[model samples]
Target: ETVIYRIYYYINRSGTGHLTLRELKRGNLIDAMLHCDEEEDINKVLRYFSYEHFYVIYCKFWELDTDHDFLIDKENLIRYGNHALTYRIVDRIFSQVPRKFTSKVEGNMGYEDFVYFILAEEDKSSEPSLEYWFKCIDLDGNGVLTRNEMQFFYEEQLHRMECMAQEPVLFEDILCQMIDMIKPQLVKTDYFTCLTIEISCLQDESYIMLRDLKGSKLSGSVFNILFNLNKFMAFETRDPFLIRQERENPTLTEWDRFAHREYIRLSMEDDVEDASNGSAEVWDESLEAPF
Candidate 1:
């Protein structure tokens, strides 16, 4: 309990004690963490802080398990045809998770897999997440992403960008940019140091929003579609009733912080409504037997 609060404090604004949709709309987790000098050290802190999202992730797992069969099928992921959830993103997910780890050949994901997907999406800097995506990007499973594999993902990204009628980006230029970001240091590089910097910038100063880069929609979304949705809600949505409004530090990843706050908000609303309804029921049954 104490540990969770300690983590939650750093992950959220201190005055608010947890993230609010308002603060998230202004910026993202990186903005909060970068107020400090060392991003690499902040990344390390985030890796051990997964426990901060334990509650929301558990709640969401069951929510995605539509069949009550203790698994999330492709149909579950495609729920209601939400436009932000693209087919390519969902398809790649099943293709990546090992068959042995999945619940069925039909590509159903169990709770553990769902958690891995969320962690990978929310904290690409984490070792578990970095390796999880490495497995996916390394389609051939030969321990590295070959030219063909890069082409494969890039082709889909290009197609999606074109379909959206956004200006097309020259594949060559994008490739050069990616190469530099992924392997910036030729000697003793931390490898993933800046790889995720551009790919998973969920803060308001996002690489996508800043550069307005085409196909950046799924730059990291192919790894998890919900990631994009969380960003949309955090950055685009405003507080309807002017709820709690303040800011401090950012400890949780933007997606994790967003989901956690949404869960708490909905839960509190339910409690208030339930209490009123219970009181009304008691008054109406006042004449009935207590037994």
Candidate 2:
């Protein structure tokens, strides 16, 4: 780690021993590492840096910054979408987790906060990213999610599902689905009742919750995707402007893997359809025309 740090210090070029968010946005991290002394190829560890991932993230931050203030306010996000998906994204982003205080408004996010948010959103299984989300969802900053906070987002989703469904889906059914995925140890439902969500997915209710898990977090992005994900499928329909997940080695998140599996599934489906169609055509034209 020390050797890598030394190499990174020189690669920083700013002589500050740290790579600023601006430095990342401007160009690729590996490109900078390549310029390092040719004697040792520091770029070998490029996979560890997530050079491309950070670039995409920086670009996204720039896009959403809108006013160029290097920050995103709730107004800007709400304008991003008035729908349930947007509401949940906004809710999680502005959760009561403590920050350095970039905005006085209820839920504004600066670049640093945005970076973690994107990371967790991109990779649900990441322990670190999960923790970042947990902080946001833990509105009371009590290290656990309360009923009010969870319902605030769930209710919006309920209204949304209702509009899209041919039939009404009770909150309990949704909870059951969510419980299967999130598997919150203590199942508290009744819609109006305060909900307490432990971050872990353990089946045992008496077991330790996610908050108690070392380096644990629960981001809204992951929850939204998981809640709607059907087996290996989860469409990122919530955020139209959501940043594309970078596929660099070691950077592939659970979502990425799932998407890849889904892609294979689709490809197989297409192949089967084409084969069936070809067989039908062959049978139909079993006898050639007079020519």
Candidate 3:
């Protein structure tokens, strides 16, 4: 029942309480499925059935599952992306505020849960990712992301920056930037007054609506700025090569890029480990006495 509902929810992207054939065909899913059936190699269907993507997801889980267990606890997940996510966000995830855990285990997240998390973490611009984060940030479950709620997450990020000896960006400055970028409808104010009012006052009058975030291309950056330090920094640096890649291959999702990069990194690490083991074996053989 859980799996069925999840599939239905995702397929019904329109949220009109109805799943249309048009929506199903939106991403060429049907065509991809047809090709996937025809081809002996499912990996060739990069959109959904790509083996590369599954390999990336599984590799991420394997790396985090240090005990070789099939599940990961909070500590394990914290190590993800070199601890890119803030503790507050991790807490929210463990709390299952964004989505309920399918795993029957008390505190550990299963592979399926990790897949949901990694996809959402990597691709915040997508509808499901945006929704995932919004629920996590909406700490009170009020459906709206209030200033206090946003700051609750950003506080740790600020502390992390200070601890790292980096010039910390104040929450006020970040709020201003978010307002400018998202331009969410102010509760009791207009855009003209926003410039004149103090940051503290603006907090009471401003809130981020889901639509506001969904409308912006930089929605992912908003979440990154709040909790994921590594990604947020990368966003600020604005790598021209990445920008060029996005322009060149607009069809590729953020998940695709992230998976590709991680796969290469993991493969290289495996090669290096193999080479090290081979050298160690050779050294041991040379040291062996004839008997």
Best by lDDT: 3
**The CA-based lDDT of model 1 is what?**
0.47
Model 2 Cα lDDT, one tens digit per residue, 130-165? 565556555566445544555555565556556667
Clash number by candidate, in order = 3, 4, 0
Candidate 3 on 1-291: residue-level lDDT in tens? 222233344565665557687878664556767887899886666666676777677778777987766689999999999999898899899999877786889898877678778878988878888998999998767566778888989999999999999999999999988878888865555335445444554456457878789889888999999999999889888999999989998988897888788879878877987878755223233322111
Q: Residue 64 in model 1: shift from native, Å?
A: 2.7
Query: What are the per-residue Cα lDDT tens digits for candidate 1 across 226-285?
Result: 223433333334454322332333444445555556568657855887878755223233
Worst 10 contiguous positions by lDDT, candidate 2: 225-234
Candidate 2: residue 138 lDDT (0-100): 55
Displacement of the residue 14 alpha carbon in candidate 3, Å: 10
Backbone clash total for model 3 is 0
Q: How accurate is candidate 3 locally (lDDT)?
A: 0.78
TM-score of each: 0.50, 0.49, 0.81
